[model samples]
Target: MNILLENIKILAENENISISKLEKEIGSSQAVLSRAIAKNTDIQAKWVLKIAEKYPQYSCDWLLKKEGPMLREMTKNTDIYGLLEDGVENFKILTTSQKQIIESLQKVIFYLEKQDETGRQEKNKNN
Candidate 1:
């Protein structure tokens, strides 16, 4: 998934809001939002501002960085993961086992995402 889309998904899941609802709240069309998420088109500053306004809890920096805290506030001694403070060569030195572990974690995350989507749909149905 595109980074922007991942950010959008994170915000949606965190706020318990549907993509459609979020698009509407941000004054953007579903097609525009979908394209932006897919990385097929660029998102304008206005769209970002709208989202920031609607979700004041999100940090713009965190939204753009995989290593940053999802929430703006950080507790002491928090070991943030996926942070890249070094060069690409450093990342390339990871062992095969490390790569496998990361892949496995990604799969697990995808599974949880599917469950979250199901729950959200069910909740919407109930309402």
Candidate 2:
């Protein structure tokens, strides 16, 4: 139940949508959504259908059983890096600030990788 809610939160964040928006899209009130997520009551099958229809990118298996890939399909174009790049590009079309943030994050990731490599080399030297 908590796991289902957490996955919903993750999906909402990744899609740049608010929980309110998700609830509206699924034709459920926030209170009902909360109750369903908390397992206080069983979620209706219609609600599941609404979500599956709206967010086809989510793996049904993962959403229901947590036993498969998080995404519906496995493809180079659908990898996390590809999705992140697509998100940054979409944000770039809307605002320069988003582009700057993406650039900063790229630089931070580069620096972290370099630091990791350096640490590995130092460890090898000590060995």
Candidate 3:
């Protein structure tokens, strides 16, 4: 099997999705990836790009070159706001309603955090 196909298989397995599902997500015709893997042929570059675009959490460099972590690294210091912003920015394929839901969820999280902080402060004062 080709190394690229092997890596793609690994990626699909790790994601817990079948090759058919991956083909649908990346807009490839049915059995496209499967046929390539079976025949030991190379896939088109556009398919790779589409896969990368559809799944931004995976490292594109690693997908192509296998040179880095399979998953993109998140900084330890990143806050919720940073994650939300990154999600909105990087996930261009997300539907408008999905983005709106993310925004709504962020608001809820902020409210909850504020409530928790207030409770902690009250407890500190009572101590």
Best by TM-score: 3
Measured against the true structure, the TM-scores of the candidates, in listed sequence, are: 0.50, 0.49, 0.58
Candidate 3 lDDT, 1-127, residue by residue in tens: 8566787898899999999999998989999999999998767666765676576566655665576788865442233455466676434433443454355345434544665688789999999
Instruction: Give per-residue lDDT, candidate 3, residue 1.
Output: 83
Between candidates 1 and 3, the TM-score winner: 3
- Report the lDDT tens digits of candidate 1 across residue range 24-57: 9898977667767666454655565577556644
lDDT of 2 by residue, 95-116 (tens): 5433433453454345446656
Model 1, 108: alpha-carbon shift in Å? Answer: 30
Each candidate's lDDT (Cα)?
0.60, 0.61, 0.68
* lDDT, model 3, position 83: 47
Order of the predicted models by TM-score, top scorer first: 3, 1, 2
Cα RMSD of predicted structure 3: 20.2
Candidate with better lDDT, 1 vs 3 = 3
Cα deviation of 113, candidate 3, in Å = 49
